[model samples]
Target chain A: MIVVEALSKQFGRFQAVDEISFEVQRGEVLGFLGPNGAGKSTTMKMLTCYLPPTSGNAEVNGFSINSQPLQVQEQIGYLPESAPSYNEMQVEEFLTFIGEVRGFSGTELRRKVGRVLELTSLQDARKQIIDTLSKGFRQRTCLAQSLIHDPPVLILDEPTDGLDPNQKHEVRELIRRMSEERTILISTHILEEVEAVCSRALIISEGRLVGLGTPDELLSQSIYRNAVTLSVSGKSAEALLEDLNGLEQVYSVERLEDMPSGALTVRVFPKDRESISSELEQFLKKKKMVIEQFFVERGRLDEVFRNLTLGN
Target chain B: MKGLFPIFKRELLAYFRSPVAYVFIIIFLAANAGCTFMLGNFYDSNQASLEVSFLFHPWLYLFLIPAVGMRLWAEERRSGTGELLLTLPVRTSVSVFGKFLAGWAFIAVALILTFPMIITVHYLGFPDNGPIITGYLGSFLMAGAYLAITSFTSALTKNQVISFILSVNICLILVLLGWGVLSEILNTIFPVWLTDVISQFSFTTHFDAIRRGVVDLRDIVYFLSIIIFMLMTNVVVLESKKAS
Candidate 1:
């Protein structure tokens, strides 16, 4: 539903978004991962047509953001960073105003506003003035207005930035429910948010796309892939490590500290792209060595993200 | 036009949503009455017409209009609703004109509330209603012009105080161009025709024409042109901010 091509935004000597290109199809929720000053907000602003890109542009739902910005804006429901809203307005009134601007009125405007309020769980606070609402409520009110038009694409900047853990989970579930038909691009510094809600993620740093893939794909690229940790009894870790080193797929083996229960812990590193589980099991059976714990670990995404964005 | 309706409604409703509109109205009514009776000496002049009240409008609007217009754009920027308003599927003209109209309507409300003085004048004697009606018209037009200038200054910065001060300075200069002493000082160095043309741009000159019971087309057009010119500048300012 959205395509950005070689889009760059430079402010005098500083480049905020540098020649970054990406596409998001309907039903895809793309997580934008970056730290502070990483151009996440700037990229979303360019996409929303809030700021014109210094060069190049993006298209939303078949409309150029530069040439047909009004049309592009009609199709986008942007939740700017900090979720700015008119503080003097009541929540219900604000949503109605947005609905009216989106070309809905009378029964239609009422119905759309009602629907968004329900979706964002803002019905109870609808009567309260925006400035009087709590931060979580205010954020949800922002979310409500973005949905007031039922746009095909949503660009949310830190939707759950200051929410409590429960509120964050609720918003995540809401995004998940809405992810079936809408294309969503949400930027967040919270790594686990990508793991929880995004089908694919793009990690940007220093105004460049550093990593782009499914969470699992990026995780598998970590150095920890195919590494195994084992706890065994009836054998010293030295003996186990020595035997595991003799296996063909075993790249290396190291002994860990002894467990509190006296079981020796050892870690086995398999050769690249190799899985030695079955062979190691058979070898253990042949030796009659009892195993306490055996775990073949998946790579940690946090470790992968840190290496991708900050390593370079 | 349809797209601008909601923005206009929201902006107009914003004034009433807070105490700013009420406080402004009360203070405005008192100030207008004070300027007419205390400074213009309306009763002492024994003027059955609203000439004294109308005469002080330009001076009163100099400060009052800017106070109302300063927050029109600066508050939006400070509160971050600039993003919300600008991202709507409306053209820059729609937003700019909508907000300008809302503020102009507010100044209209303040002007309309001076009806008690009008009633007083009519009850005191058979006043020439023609002059009074055109006087209010000129005052309203001059207000629209001053408000347009204030709106432009407001768009230049996010600070309300700076917006107010800048607008007051600009409005003061525009007002002073037609002042007697200023013209006298300028006529010493410049040609008489040049001085006349320079003073013609002042709001006071056109306002004076209308206040004298003559609603000339050029005077009306002059006030409207100033409003249009400033709002066009407002559009450029808003657009250029987005470009960077």
Candidate 2:
């Protein structure tokens, strides 16, 4: 439902977003992962028709952001970074104003407002001034405004930023619940949010697109993928490390720190993307080594994100 | 155009929902009344017309109109609400016109609340309704022209104070350009034709012409053109923010 074609935005000599191209299909939640000032907000602004790209363009629901901005805006709902809103307005009044601006009026407007307030769980704070509400409620109010029109496409810039853990979880749950019907592109620095909510992840750094794939696919790029870690108590650390390295299936082995209880932990790297845990287990059993703990690493997103976005 | 009504309605209501509209109206009435009675000496002038009252409008609007208009775009830009507003399915012109009309309507409300001045003048003497009515039309149009300039200045920056100061200075120059003493001083320094042309560009000249009951098409066009020009420039300023 969204196609970004070599989109580039330049502010004077600094290139904010440079030749970035990606597409998001319906029923897909694409997590935009980037560090601070990685042009993530810039890209989302261009997609939402708030900022004009200097060289290239984007399309939402087949409407070009450059030539058909109004039509594109009509089809997309956007939540800007920091979740800005009018502080003087009440929660319900603010949502109602947004609903009116979105072309709903009369009973339909009230129903839409009510539905979004419920969706964001802001019904209790309906008549309360937004300025007096807590940060979580204010963020939810802004979220409610974005969802008032029920647009098919949502572009949220840091939807969970500045929220507490529980609020973040609730927002992720809301996004997940809505993901089945809408195309969502959320930019966030939190890797766990991407893992919990996104079907595909796109990583960018320094205005360049570096990694794009499913969470598992991106994690596979990490060095720790398919690696085995074991904690032994009876064997000497050096001997176990040497023995684990001698095996043909084992690529290398490193002795991890000794635990407080005097147990030694070691990580074994496999020669390929295959299970080495069983082989290591058999080798330890033959060596009369007491294995206390063993598990295979399924890879980590943070490690993958760091590897892709490092040195930027 | 499609987004005009909602935008206008929201902006208009926003004023009343806060202390801005009430405080502005109260201060405006007090200052206008003070100017007429204390400074212009309305009772002492022994005039049957509201000319004494109309004379202070140009000066009163220098600060009052900017107060009403400085937040038009500056607050939106500062609070990042412009991002939400512009992203709506509306043309830039719609927001520009809608916001301008809202501020103009708000100043209209403040102006209408000064009805006691009219009642006092009529009760005290048989005032000529022609100049009184034209005086009000001239004041309303002048307020719009001043507000358009404030809106334009407001869009130039996100600081409301800076917007207010810049527009006040601009309006001050426009007022001084056509004031009697200023024009006489300039006439001594420059040629007669040059002083005449300079004075013609001043808002005071056109507003004064309208207040005197002449209602010339040129004077009406002058106020309207300034409003249009400033609002058009306001749109350009906002649109350029996206490119930069």
Global Cα RMSD, each model? 2.0, 1.5
Summed backbone clashes in each candidate are 0, 0
* Model 2, C-alpha of B155: deviation from truth (Å): 0.4
lDDT of candidate 1 at residue A270, scale 0 to 100: 84
Off by over 4 Å in 2: none
Fnat of all models, as shown? 0.73, 0.75
Report the C-alpha lDDT of model 1 over A90-204, residue by residue, as the tens digit. Answer: 9999999988877888998998989998998888999999999999999999988998888899999999988999999999999999999999999998888988999999999
Measured against the true two-chain complex, the DockQ scores of the candidates, in the order shown, are 0.72, 0.80
Report model 1's TM-score to 2 decimal places: 0.95
Overall lDDT per candidate, in order of appearance = 0.90, 0.91
Candidate 2 lDDT for residue A308: 83
**Model 2 chain B worst lDDT run, 10 consecutive residues:** B1-10
Model 2 / residue A151 / CA error / Å: 0.7
lDDT of 2 by residue, A38-117 (tens): 89999999998888999887889999999999999999889999788988889998898888877889999999999998
In model 1 chain A, which range of ten residues has the least summed lDDT?
A: A233-242
Top model number, TM-score: 2
